[model samples]
Each structure stands twice: as structure tokens, then as C-alpha cells.
Target: MALKQSFSQKMEQKLSPQQIQLMKLLQVPTMELDQRIKEELEVNPALEEGKEEEEDEFEQEEYEEEIGEDERDFDIDEYLTDDEPAYKTSVSNKSKDDEEKSMPLSSGKTFQELMLSQLNMQKLTEKEVLIATYLIGSLDDAGYLERDLESIVDDLAFSQNVMTTEDELEGVLHYVQELDPPGVGARDLQECLILQMERRQDGDITRYTALKILEDHFDEFVKKHYKKITAKMEISEEDLKDAVHEIIRLNPKPGGSLKSSSKSLQQVVPDFQIVDEDGKLVLSLNGRNAPELKVSQGYKKMLQNYSEGAKLQKKDKEALTFVKSKLDSAKWFIDAIQQRQNTLFSTMTAIMNYQKDYFLTGDDTELRPMILKDIAEIVDLDISTISRVANSKYVQTQYGTFSLKHFFSESLSTDSGEEVSTREVKQILLEAVEDEHKRKPLTDEKLASLLKEKGYNIARRTVAKYREQLNIPVARLRKEL
Candidate 1:
């Protein structure tokens, strides 16, 4: 017997406006931060750039307070005074109201647009085009449309008022696969490569291997079961080697050309730069993406003028309120951007210090075990906030630009009880495989034993896990013959 309650309390959790703001801010990248600010400026009339006349007094008071604190310190008058022209800018004081209203909205062709253009050029029947269009729409940003044929068929029949068969749609899918890039409409990796190979006229070794792998023993082929392949085919070691080479040459992704999974071209822009100055490393935040923003000085002045009037108009009061809210939002945004820069610099500086040996020597072996919590604690920020900064963000070094997330690797203890990075083990494993004899590839068990000899007590299963993470196939796949 179960007791059933007639009434249940509903639990509701709501995020603070500030938390929501921070979440939105975290979502914005360095490249888009300026544009976001400009967008805010356009939507909120109270939001303007540079200081208003009213804030000048407050700014002076703050400056005086800092200067008064220490007379013996370097004079701050130069930085504060208008005469010094340190903060003077040609565009900073421009009229905010007239500028934003006249700007045109941006529009551009997306991935769908490009694909639709190709479809339009093809001599497709209306029904075929409808199916093709629906199929194209179903695909994700990775260019993968994982839905089954039945679902698509149902969707077309019900929504488009067009009766279509899965077989017919599948036929059209084949036609789409034969479009630009050779393997666009393939259902999976094997199909994609096979489609490309089917279209190729050359009977190269790579093509032969690709066809064999796709048509037969695809599972074993992917798992690197080269021995099974050779045993079943009764092929010589040399022929097997050529077959494997051929398979390696074919593109794994069929629709990669249409929509690459890598960061969008615009997103590749680095957020920070580290330049050597004199004998020290100087880190500069790319603030160009953070445009100049300030409260609407004219609006604030108007509010002050209206406040003294005996009776303020309804429109005027509404305007004043709107101006204040927008000004506050603008100020909050600017402050958040400033805070973001400081936090980013501080966190990165701490990382650079912690991993000084790795940076100075450029040795992967020297990379110490570091987690987000370690840096978060050092930088006095929450781990989640630190993660937000690291995610999808790139730091440019003299060697090359790498994602900030690359530096943080989980720690692994060796057989000797010495802690090291898992990256180091992966690197060592990669090197060993690279140097091993290709005719007889080293099995995971043999790799484990070799690692044990090298004082790395990793198991065979663990070796497989690491190898898989590195996108390396097993010993059989690595075999040439």
C-alpha cells in the first residue's frame, strides 16, 4: 500500500539579476565583447560613452583621495588633469544619441544558405528538393544529421503535404553525397569514405584500403585489427600495408568542407597577447574588443535641469528613468569588462608563474600537475568563474597560440610514487608508438610492459584508454603489413 499525497509543494529557484548578467558576460568571447557593448548602447539610450559632467566631480574627488593618501608617492596629478591629455580621445566625446539611431543592422548568409544555393543549381524535382531541403535543415552545426530515414519520411509526409518514401529520400541522399567535397551526405564515417572512394577513378592503394575497410571488417579496421584483416584476405604483408595506407588517406569527415567543427574563422582571434619587454614578460589584454562606453552626459544633464522645474512632463520623467537604467547598465557592463580583464591577467600571471619551468624551457615533461581549483584559489576567484575564463579562450605565446584549457592537465602518480601529468604519459606513449617497428606493431600489453620498465605502472586497459583519447588505433591498426 502506497500513500499518495493530494497536494505537493512546488520548489522554485530564481537567479539574481547580477548572476544572470555575469552568466551572459561569461558567454561573450573577447572578439564579440565590443559588439555586445555597442548593441547595448544602441538599445539603451541612457547608455553612452565616456564620463558625464556630473561624474567629473566624483572622479576628481577619488583622484584627490588617492593623491592625498601619499604625498611622497609619484604625483597622480598628471593622470587626473585634462591638461595632461592622458585620457583624451577624439571619439570618446562624440554625440551618442545621433550616432546609434542611424546604424544599419547586420545580415549575412549562413551554412544553410550556402547549401540551399547548391541545391537550387541542381536539376532536382520539386519533391526531391523538398526532401533535400528538409534533410539539410535537420543537420546540426557539425553537418551531421543523426535522425533516421523513417522520422524524416514522416516529417515530410505530414508537414510538407508531400508523400515520399524513405527509399526515394535515401536515393536523393546519395545524390547529395556526390555533391561538392565528395562525401557530404554519408550516414557515417565508413559510408562517407566509401562514397568518396566510389566516385574516385584512380585505383590507388589508399583507395583500395579505404574500400576494403569500409566494405569489410570496418569495426575491426577501426579498432586496428590488421592481423585479422590480413588473415582473412590472405594478402601479403606488403599489400596489407598498402591497403592500410590507402584507408588512412581518405577523409574521415564527409561534410567537413561545408561546416568545419573547429572554431569559426572569426572565433580563432586570440584574446590575449604575451610579449617580452626588456627582460620581462608583458601581458596585454586585447581591449580593442572592449569599446569605449560611458553614461549619456547630455541625458544626465537634462535630468538635472528637469529636476529643478516646477512640473516635469510625463515623457521627460520617463526619459529620465530610461536614461538612468541604461546608464547603470552601461556602467555595470564597463566595470564588468574591466574586472574581467584584471581577473584574466591575474589568473594567467599566476599560471605563468606556477608553470615557469615549462614556459622557460618549452618542455612538456616539466609541465606540473595543475587543476582549475589550484589557479582559482591562487587568483581568489571561484573555480566556475576560472573555468569560464579558460573555456574557448586562447593565449598567444611566442611559440604559438594555444587554448588556455591546454595547460590544465590531471595529475597522475608514477610507479615510483612521483606525481606527473597524464599529458607526459600520453606524450611518452605517442613517441614510443611513433618509433616502434611498423611491420609488427607493439600491442597495448607490450606498451604497458614497456611503460612499467620506464617506471610508469600503467595497465593495459589504461594504455588503451590513453591511446583512444589520442585518436590512435590499437597495435593491429598500427601494423603496416
Candidate 2:
């Protein structure tokens, strides 16, 4: 085959660097946006913090004429002018004290570190310590030993060249399980519960009864077959209730109890705030989302001085190019931030307006059916842009702070040919479950029938799907004696 040249022309859509920056800025929350601005300010010396100065229109126009319009997309003088919108506001996502002061970093030991500290205190040999350390590393965030002992044995022999057997590892694990925060190092849920119960096995009848229930009838207990358990254990319902009360109080996620296991506890900084003033809803963007920024005045003066030089030199031209690049970058960043504020405010405004009834009443049933497309249409932006505005962004209302993604849900039809948000149906299902009689919880089919009586055209399978989405378990597990 031989290479050949052909002429083909096709129109394409590509985002400019400024557009890409705006898109990225839209996705960052208020807390991150502040850090991002600091990074940009550090890297670009031409950008600075603080209020912009009021410049004379004649001077600004002259500066614009000096920096030719054909060389760049935006005028630097426009970004430096004081007439720009006041982006900074008083409200913050945190409390007034939080805004004044920041929380100190945590200096706490991780789960593995705590486990190793306990292991070191135990009477174990050097090689056993390494194996126990490896075992500590294998536990998940929930504190369960996810890997099997046989695989760990093979891994130790193959990777570390430390010959070990299943029985040996099991013996070491017994000591690990005895560490603080009970139920950690267990293989599965059953084992985790059993480990916790074994630690609490005192001479008391209630404690022994709970241990026996866990040790023998764990499967029956897990399935919530209360009658079968009562019959098998030869215990009354009151006695079984007391025993289960003990088991229920045990921590299932012992590893999660570690302060360090929560990777990073991010303080939620909402991007927007909504207030109801005499039944009218008002929305405002967070102060950090639209930080105060301006091009460095010193850099601007440097450009003016270089341009006003009597005679131009090669070095002067290079300096002018360098300063111009920094100014351009600063201008682009300021413009992107402004556009992000507009896009964010517009998208959220549409969402708030659409769900006005819900926000006003603080009722989940009042929420209207909404999606990214709906907000995109109202804001006249792309669906993905609306999605970015919704992602990882929260809004504070009188009721509580909620993620923007929480407002958008799929639509379902009613018997009266009306469209309702699935959120409304889920709210009803949640209320039904909450008010249910524990002696005989309603099944999915019964839930569907009840919804049908309420004029919500839902099917039995659809009820089951909605129930699962709400994290409501089956009727069998829901039943209580």
C-alpha cells in the first residue's frame, strides 16, 4: 500500500482551554475550590487575591488598545475593572465559628497500627509477629478477614518465603480476635457476631443464651425464623427477645470503629443556600464558590512600563510575552470562575424552583419529578454540564443540607393520569414500613395493593423494586415477635 493525500473538510466541535477549565471548576465543591484557587495563585504570579481596584475608563481603554484584541480572546482590562459583579458574600457552608477557625487534623492510629500494637504486647515470637502483621493488613474496612486462610498460607510461602500452615495462622488469628474492638479479624458476618458474643459470655443466663443462639442457631437467627428458634431453644418469646437484644447491641463493623478507618472525614460545604422568606424561596451561591480574584496590579504596571519604553529591545519583548502569558492565564481563570458561578446558580435555581413545594413544606411527597435533562433544558446548557453542577454539590435549606443529586428522580404515573416523582412513592413506602405492625409486616404484594388503594398505579414487582431501593428488607426479615 502507498500513502495518498486527499482533501477532506469536516466541521468539529472542540472545547477551548477556558471552557475546559470552567468545566473542571464546575465539578469542584466550595471547599476544594478554595484550595484550587490557592494552587493557581501560587503557580501564576500574575494572579492575586483581594478586591479589584477601580480603574479609569480612559486608562483601561488605552491598556486594551495596547494589548491588541486580535492576539487573544479576552481583554485584560475588563477582568481588572472594579465594575465586575461582587462575587463574595457573607454566608458560608459551615457555622460562623467554623468560618472563623478551621478544625485541627486528627493524630490517631489506624486499625492496622492498633492491631500491631496489641500484637507486640502479646507473647509471640519474631516470625509470628510478621505473620500476624500480614494478617492485620488483610482485614477490610469493616474489620472482616476477607481472604481465606489457605490462600494466606500459600501467599506466605510463595511471596514472603515464610512457610506457614492454615492451623498456624488460625492460632495466631485467635489472639488477634482477642484485641480491642470486638468482632474484628472475623472471617464472615457469622464469625464476626460469634466472636463478639464469645467475648461477652459471662455466667449470666442472658449472656449464655445469646452465645448459644449465635453458636448453634445463627442461621435460624439470621433468617429471622423466631418461632423456629423459640422451639429449638425451648425458650419463651420474652426470653428470646432479651437474648436478641444483647446480640443486636454488638458492633458488626469493629474495624470501622477506628477513627483512622474513615480515610478522610470531609466536612460538607454546601455550594448553595436556600431561604424561605414569607413562603418565598430564595437561593444564594456559597461565598467560597465565587472567591475574590484579580490580575496582579504590579504585573499590569510592568506590562505598561515595558510598552512605554522609548526603544524596544529583544529582552523587553521577551519580558512582555512572559507577562502577557501570565495575565492571559489569570484573566482566563477569573472568567471561568464567573461562568461557573452563573452555571451553578442557574442550574440550582431551576432545581429549587421545580421543587418549590417540597422545599417549602419539607415533605418528600411534595418533590416533583426532575432529571438532568429538565434542568439542562431550563438553563439552556448541555445535559453533562447540568450533571456536573449536580455532582458532589450540596444545598442548604431550612429542612436540612442535601446533595443536588437528591432532587432529581424518575417519574411514575398515578391512576389519575398524573406524573409523580418516584421519590414521593419511596417516601410513602418508608412511612408504611415505619408504621407497620411488627407482628405481621406487609409483603411486597400487600404493599402494592395498599398503594393501588391510594391511587398509585404500582405493581407488586415494582413495589419490591422500590422497597429494595429504600433498603427495606423482605417481610420475613422485617417480622418481629
| Top candidate (TM-score) | 2
Model 1 weakest 10-residue run by lDDT = 84-93
lDDT measured at residue 387 in model 2 versus the true structure, 0 to 100? 88
Put down candidate 2 lDDT per residue, 1-481, tens digits, no spaces: 9999999999999999999999999999887888898899999998888777765654432432243457445444543445345433223343544444234355467778887788867898887888888888989988889999999999999888899889999998988888878898999888898899888877989989999999899999999988999999999999999999999998888888793543556678778889999999988777743457877878877766654455545676567778888988987888888788878888899999999999899999899999889989998999999988898999999899999989999998899989999999999899999999998999999898889999998989999999998899999999887
RMSD of 1: 9.9
Please report, in order, the local distance difference test score of every candidate based on alpha carbons: 0.70, 0.83
| Candidate 1 segments exceeding 4 Å error | 1-27, 50-195, 201-235, 259-264, 277-279, 311-323, 415-417, 459-461
lDDT of model 2, residue 330:
86
